[model samples]
Target: MEDEVLLTLMIEDLLAAEGFDTISAAHETEAMAHAAAAADRIAVAVVNLHLGRDVAGQRVIRALRQHVPNLPVVVITGFDSEAPQADLRGLGGPTVRLHKPGGYDELVPAVLNVMKQVRTGAWPEEGRRKTDYNV
Candidate 1:
């Protein structure tokens, strides 16, 4: 949970209560490091999309996936409109993007669903497509 304020703390607390081992990071560097070190050990990642101007959490997702490509990343968005959902979904990984203010109950199920999909090898591979776009 590498977020500055608001939902990060709440989500972390929720995860802890659910009996999951958790860690926190407030920026990109720390998040990447944590993900790398916690690879295989971490079953799921609950990431917030807007992690400052540079899309830091997106970087974390890429790096973590490089380490564990099949890793399930549950993207959290605070946007009021549905526009970001499409963009977030196209991030090309095993993911679930939820719009807020989504409750902890909803959050936990979303996280657990992705984790279940991952554990059962039921998730779709990121860039696999039927129609290839050749340059």
Candidate 2:
């Protein structure tokens, strides 16, 4: 999971504690590198929608999708809103949009569920579309 330092570390720790082998990135460039190097090992990406830069997260997601279309991405944002969540939902296939300041327990289930969908080729509860949403 590649993201800014703060989110990267937080997610890494959480996932690591949960027994997942984790890698992290602070921005799109590094995230791509990480993804490239660990292509087969990474099961999913827990990305922060805002990387404290100009659409860095969006670019990262696009690149990841191009390289590994089946790679599940769960976009996490501190800001919670229906529009942004709906926008991520527009991104077709198996991606999840979640709000932070919630519980990591919630995140765990979301991560597990999305990855399960990817592994099993199952669609999420609601069918989603591929659309660009500003985080």
Candidate 3:
């Protein structure tokens, strides 16, 4: 989920146009609530790294994983260099990292790719902790 209303709207519209239904959350709490409630229906998650104040996207990802262990995640961030890439390595599922602003170009493709992997049983690698993409 994205914190910025406009960006979230843009993403929602984009995904909707691509024929995918979307659920949006402006912060971690809303994200967690949505994820928990729809854990069985969610196919993948597109998250922003910063959610204002001290709320990080990684927190949302981790929280969702507690309910859906194999959830695929597309992490979009404006602070590419400042993001905690090292910490994300332990996320234990399929994850795609992208820089914001320009990263929009790759968002849809990334989501589709992750979904493909998930459907093909290529995600959540066997005997492996995690799978990282575009990091």
Candidate 4:
């Protein structure tokens, strides 16, 4: 999920073109609704660190996980450092991170790679890249 409408749509289209369906949400409720509604269908999640101006980003991840246990997450942020969002680290299951403006180049691979890792149960410790953001 991403807060900016255009970026959310862009990411949706990018994934759609790659033959993946996406649920785009900018707030925790919308994300939870999607996760609860399509728990079995969701294969992975690419979440924006700052979901919206009022939402706590970590809440979004937590909500998603409540429905989909061990859900592979590709956490994305625009910040250069992750010191402020230290809570995002050590989130359960296999999570991977990427910094914007990585564009689709970095996103597609991260999404696919994380899903592959989770499915095979071989998420590399080396892929644990993190960054910071706020809501």
Candidate 5:
């Protein structure tokens, strides 16, 4: 889920152009609602790590994981998903992160990468780095 309207619209249009059925959510509650309604159809999720001032996207990710245990996540954030000295490893399932502002081209690839990991059962591997979120 992304809080930025322009970015969300850009992403929605871009993904739609690529023939993806898009679902957009701006915050935790909306994310949960959409996930609940379309969990089975949601093949992957692209979330903004900070929805507004809080790291609410993390909550969305966790909730999505609880709902769809092995759901692949594509986390887009301005800061590092693996911040220095930060520890949030059990964040759940196959995941990916892409630095924001100019990584539009990487979106599809990152999503595809995580989906492949799910398909091949390669994620949640031991000793994998946190930034290993993205391909």
Candidate 6:
């Protein structure tokens, strides 16, 4: 999830056009709430690594993962060189990292690839039955 309102809307619209329903969150709380609420329906999360106002994207990723352990994450960061790539890698599960500014072009493809992995059972337990719950 992205914190920038305009960017978040743009990404949501793009994904919607691609026939995927998206849940956008501006910060950690909202992201966690949405993820917990729609844990079963959500297939993946595209998160911005730097959410303005000192909210680190890793927090969002960790919170989301708590609900959907096998969820695939596509991390978009403008601070590619400075970002904590090791920390992200440490988060584990299926992940794809894309550098920002031009990374928008890769977002869709990265999501598609992750989904492909889920569908092919490369990401085990991803499609297993899950109960739907509201937060």
Model 1 C-alpha lDDT per residue in residues 1-135, reported as the tens digit of each score: 546676677888888888988777777877888888888787788887666554566677777777786678887767643453335432445677677575455888888888888778786556554321111
Give lDDT per model, in order.
0.69, 0.68, 0.79, 0.76, 0.78, 0.75
lDDT of 1: 0.69
TM-score, predicted candidate 3 vs. hidden true structure = 0.84
Higher-lDDT candidate of 1 and 3: 3
Q: Candidate 3's residue-wise lDDT over 4-104, tens digit each?
A: 99999999988998999999998788888998899888889998878856447887888888888878889888775544542475565687777879988
RMSD (CA, Å), candidate 6 to true, equals 7.1
lDDT of 6 by residue, 1-135 (tens): 898888888899889989999888887777778877988888899988777675467777777788887678888887754445424644555777788778888788999987787667575444332321111
Cα lDDT tens digits, model 4, 1-135, are 888898898899888989998888888778778878988988899888777775356677777778887788888877554457635764675777787776457888888888898789986755354432111
Candidate 1 accuracy as TM-score? 0.76
Model 1: ten consecutive residues of lowest lDDT: 126-135
Q: lDDT per residue, candidate 5, 1-135, as tens digits?
A: 889999999889877877889989887788889978888788889988778666777778777777788888888878764674123356766877678877777998888899998999887566666654432
Candidate 2 lDDT score at position 36 = 76
Best by lDDT: 3
Q: How close is each model in CA RMSD to the real structure?
A: 4.3, 3.8, 4.1, 4.3, 3.7, 7.1
How many backbone overlaps does candidate 5 show?
2
Clashing pairs in 6: 1-47
Q: Which stretches of candidate 2 lie over 4 Å from their true place?
A: 1-6, 82-86, 125-135
Please give the TM-score that candidate 6 achieves against the real structure.
Answer: 0.81
Determine which window of 10 residues in candidate 2 has minimal summed lDDT.
126-135
Worst 10 residues of 5 by lDDT: 80-89
Q: What order do candidates take by lDDT, descending?
A: 3, 5, 4, 6, 1, 2
Runs of candidate 4 exceeding 4 Å displacement: 127-135
lDDT, residue 129, candidate 1 = 44
> Clash number for every model?
1, 3, 0, 0, 2, 1
